[model samples]
Target: MEARVMICAQTFFHRFFMINNIAQQPSSVPAGPKRAGEPEHTPHHMMVAVACLFLAAKVEEYPKFLDDVVRFTYHFRHGKEATEALMADKEGALKVEKDRVLTCERLVVSNMGFDLHVTSPHCKLGPVVDAVLEVAAAEGRTDLVREHKSLLSLATNFLNDSMHHLICLQHRPTRMAAIALAMAEKFMVGKEKIKPFPRVKVDGEMVPWWCSMRIVDDDEAISSDMMRRYMKDFHSQVYRQDDDEAIS
Candidate 1:
């Protein structure tokens, strides 16, 4: 359930960033002098993130209360004592925080042009995984079928991890889904295991199984080198924090 909500929230943030032309901005941009009537301060990233989650909950039909969203976000950021104080409305801080979130929500809505629909890669993951497994099984890769649960779980984890990065924004939903499944297969059964799945001839060249599945258009077709690069970045970037947490 949380995963579903986060996926929606991530998509919302992606769209929000794009709409505001902030997606490609460098990490730190120098602020220009303020103009008359311009806001004294912009919304903090934390505030925007919380607001995105709050709005995404509604868009996804999960519908968490605003108070709960504010409270949990506060708790996650500031720890138990601060959350308790905020909940108790100490010095009217709770009201102030909620107001900030509301303001950010309005900003997000306005910038997004009120378009709330988000197509998540999770929607495409299931069918692609099933198709791949079916093809593998037909080719006598029975182990993949036997380990279906693990494969699916790992693939789903990849999809979830993708939310933390710009990967979803960089690739189409179907391509992301197919790459996630392929990554899962490589991790579970080794690279050689994937070679048995039949490829399709596209314009005198053989393409991977996913390309034939129409997971990506002919022009957007993924190459083996590209897959390797994605996998390399996924390992180096996405799972870096997980590795650190495990180490500590």
Candidate 2:
């Protein structure tokens, strides 16, 4: 069974690998005159956000339905909740904000040259996980390593969707990778989901039942915090390192 699963996975990756080579690169902001107070960005970073969606659909093979993308992008940019949110709010009558939606779509299309296809980081993330697992095995940390591998995969899946509207993919991968790994390790240590840890009631607030676990001690938390901090600090280091090497 394991061998069959592995073979299937390999075949899937091989197909994706061939397609990934020719498809568009990841979505990026397009170049434009820098706004006041904006840091200068590379041409690649400046590709319009809409282009990112184009890339995602092509790469993930799951394009956001056109209407859904336009509606969500407008709602997201304008801070207008869709009908569902307005229905939930009893304060005022809900009307479909057609003008706002139309304007947003036009702006996005104009900025992105109406191109909706692009490459996605998801294509590259698999190899990264494999490398992480290899390192984990070398260090004899199988328990924590396996947990981390799962966390990375989950985080990557989540980001594949989130990247549609985002400019930076750096932060999510780092922060989520750490958080997921920590949670996984907590689960592995006899802190079974069956006997959850005790929850202290904070005044007027209900903590979720699942979050009541005593996952990390204070000392361990410090290490975890340091790991997170390192990821945060290192987020843009890759870009900078490449620039430095180019100059050299």
Quote each prediction's TM-score: 0.76, 0.31
Instruction: Give the whole-model CA lDDT for all candidates, comma-separated.
Output: 0.71, 0.37
Clash number for each model: 0, 13
- At residue 90, candidate 2 shows an lDDT of 35
**Candidate 1, 88-201: lDDT as tens digits:** 974487777777688789888888889888878888888876776766777777767777787788888888888887777877788787777777766654544433445556
Which 10 consecutive residues of model 1 have the lowest summed lDDT? 25-34
Give the poorly placed runs of model 1, Cα more than 4 Å off.
18-40, 191-207, 214-220, 223-248
lDDT, candidate 1, equals 0.71
Best candidate, lDDT = 1
- Look at candidate 1 and give me any clashing residue pairs: none
